[model samples]
Target chain A: MPYVNVKITNEGATPTQKAEVIAGITELLQRVLGKNPATTVVVIEEVDTDNWGIGGEPVTLRRRRGL
Target chain B: MPYVNVKITNEGATPTQKAEVIAGITELLQRVLGKNPATTVVVIEEVDTDNWGIGGEPVTLRRRRGL
Candidate 1:
């Protein structure tokens, strides 16, 4: 069993995209570690860009710079 | 910052395996969200079979059942 928590800056990701990501991560665990996908839990949390930072700069600023 | 926490059942995972998982997650964030890897934090937690629960049963019991 695995509990995977992924926090991504809330830029712009469709629900479909997030669902695909969750499925991909679950598949990764099953294929690489032989983990059962039935018991795996994947939670995706979208953090506000203001709360997310990169290299000490807020993600909002980075996004504005096209980074 | 993107904090990715992965909790895997501590049945059998080498240091090398954990490293690969961490690296893969970091790359995923960078590629998907354009988040800088330098600010991404990936922590792999080894969950004891006794503590991890799945399908309303402890992982230890589930493992014994080959689930």
Candidate 2:
């Protein structure tokens, strides 16, 4: 079975929101990519602002310095 | 930084196509989600026809039995 790993960082997402996103992805894969929902596994990883980056720069630092 | 994992099954996809998809995803995350491309990780899994399924059914068996 095809394995799809999806990680999205959303500081404001609640547990329910995370679950919804996973379900949505599963549905999308089944309909769009024709993947088997049974075999498809979705993994969601939430990263804190400190651990994330943008344009090869640390997001936390940028936000803190107002850069 | 946001991590988005995309899994697509394409029996006809080449290695180059896979790389292209990864790049596209990275770019999309940067533009759409304002994620850092440096920290974004994309993993693509290629499932064999026999190993994949659809609609809670085994895709391989369906294709084989011509169902």
Candidate 3:
């Protein structure tokens, strides 16, 4: 059961962009990993600006604390 | 942007087993997808016996309905 869930947190991507991203990733997984596309469920979670991280640190916290 | 969220729902896995599964998948991604392991955020959410599906049907619902 190889269900790939994709979570994206960025301010510049719209719903269409999110859909396209998931579709592209799904295709990649199918082609590269030989995973069945039918069973692979790609979930795209669009996190707001308050819940994101980069470089082992939360983006919001880093911005708020100036770290 | 390439955060992989793995959600497993079954009655046959412990936390350490789940972690190993994630680690194995991460290695596969790094080797096959050419993704950087350092930046790859792999989240494993273990679900109880309620929220699982198979063959275009919910497992719990199917069990309850005897379908």
Candidate 4:
């Protein structure tokens, strides 16, 4: 079984967009690894800007600083 | 910075339970790997039984057959 997890910044992704992401990831895995779609699990998690950071600064703060 | 993704079978996990999972994972990473909690991200995703399978049979079907 292939379990794919995707993390997208909380930029207000709609339901349709999320569905497409799941479908696309599943298709990619199937085409590349010949994995069965039935056994493939694709999960998308939208994280808060404050909880996600890079370069020792939260995304929220980084955005405020124009970085 | 560490990003942790947790996938759990959708057996009606409550918000409290999910929180615990997130917290526990963050703590484990901090204790073992010395990851900073502020930059650590933990996301939990629940998968449907019908979409999750093992041995070429969906989990839902396996449950029905008591397998």
Candidate 5:
């Protein structure tokens, strides 16, 4: 079983968008890796900007500084 | 950098619990794989029962059928 995790900043992604992402990733793995969609687990995580970091700083501060 | 994603059913896990999970995973990676905690990313995704699937059925249906 292939477990895929997609992490994205919490920017109000709609349910439809989340569904599409799950389907797309499942289909991609099936097409490219011959993986079974039924056994493949795709998890989507929407992280708060304050908890997401880059370049040793949180995304909130990065966005605040317009970086 | 090692990225770890923990997926669990939406069961009222508190922020403190989530933080502990992150910290625990980070420390585990550091001890086992020599990964840097600063660069290690741990994401926790609490999925709805309706969305989580097992054995060709959603968890919601499985729970309803008492499987």
Candidate 6:
């Protein structure tokens, strides 16, 4: 089984966007890796800005600093 | 950087439990794979029962059937 986990910032993505992402990843894996969509698991996670870090600082701080 | 994604059924896991999971996975990767915890990313995604599937059936249906 092919498992794909996508992590994105929690910036108000809708359910339709999430569903599209799941379908796209599944299709990509099926076309390239020959994985079965039935067994392929795609999970989308939206991380809060404070929890996601970049360059030794949280995304929230980075955004505040205009980075 | 080692990125670890954990998927679990949405069964009311508390924030403390989630924190523990992140720490545990980071430590495990550091000990076993010599990965840097500073650069390691651990994300936890909890899937709803209706969205999660097993044996070609949704988890909600399976749970109802006592499977």
Best by DockQ: 1
- Which candidate achieves the best TM-score against the true structure? 1
lDDT of 6 by residue, A1-67 (tens): 8988788989899999999999999999999989999999998878866555433334566578887
**What are the iRMS values of all candidates?**
1.6, 4.8, 6.8, 6.2, 3.9, 4.7
TM-score of 3: 0.47
Candidate 4 collision pairs: none
**lDDT (tens digit, per residue) of candidate 2 on B5-59:** 5645446666775666567656655554566788777766566666567767766
10 residues in a row with least lDDT, candidate 2 chain B: B1-10
lDDT of 5 by residue, B1-67 (tens): 9988777989799999999999999999999989999999998878876556443344565588886
TM-score of each: 0.79, 0.55, 0.47, 0.55, 0.57, 0.56
The sequence of per-residue lDDT tens digits that candidate 5 reaches over residues A1-67 is 7887678899787656666676777778888998888887766667899999999999999999888
Cα shift from native, residue B4, model 1 (Å): 0.6
Error of 1 at A53 (Å): 5.1
In the order shown, the candidates' DockQ scores are 0.59, 0.31, 0.23, 0.08, 0.14, 0.09
lDDT of 3 at A43: 73
> How big is the positional error of residue A45 in model 4, measured in Å on the Cα after superposition?
5.8
Q: Write candidate 3's Cα lDDT for A1-67 as tens digits.
A: 4466765555455566556655665565455445456766777665775667686777677667864
- Model 4 per-residue lDDT tens digits across residues A1-67: 7998778779899999999988998899899999999999988878766545444445666678886
Off by over 4 Å in 6: A1-6, A11-45, A48-67
Worst 10 residues of 4 chain B by lDDT: B14-23
Q: Tell me, per candidate, how large a share of the native contacts it keeps.
A: 0.56, 0.42, 0.40, 0.06, 0.04, 0.00
Chain B TM-score (each prediction, in order): 0.90, 0.73, 0.64, 0.91, 0.85, 0.91
Worst 10-residue lDDT window, candidate 3 chain A:
A26-35
Residue B36's lDDT in candidate 2:
73
- Candidate 2 scores an iRMS of 4.8
Binned by DockQ into CAPRI classes (incorrect, acceptable, medium, high), candidate 2 is: acceptable
How does each model score on lDDT? 0.80, 0.63, 0.61, 0.75, 0.78, 0.77
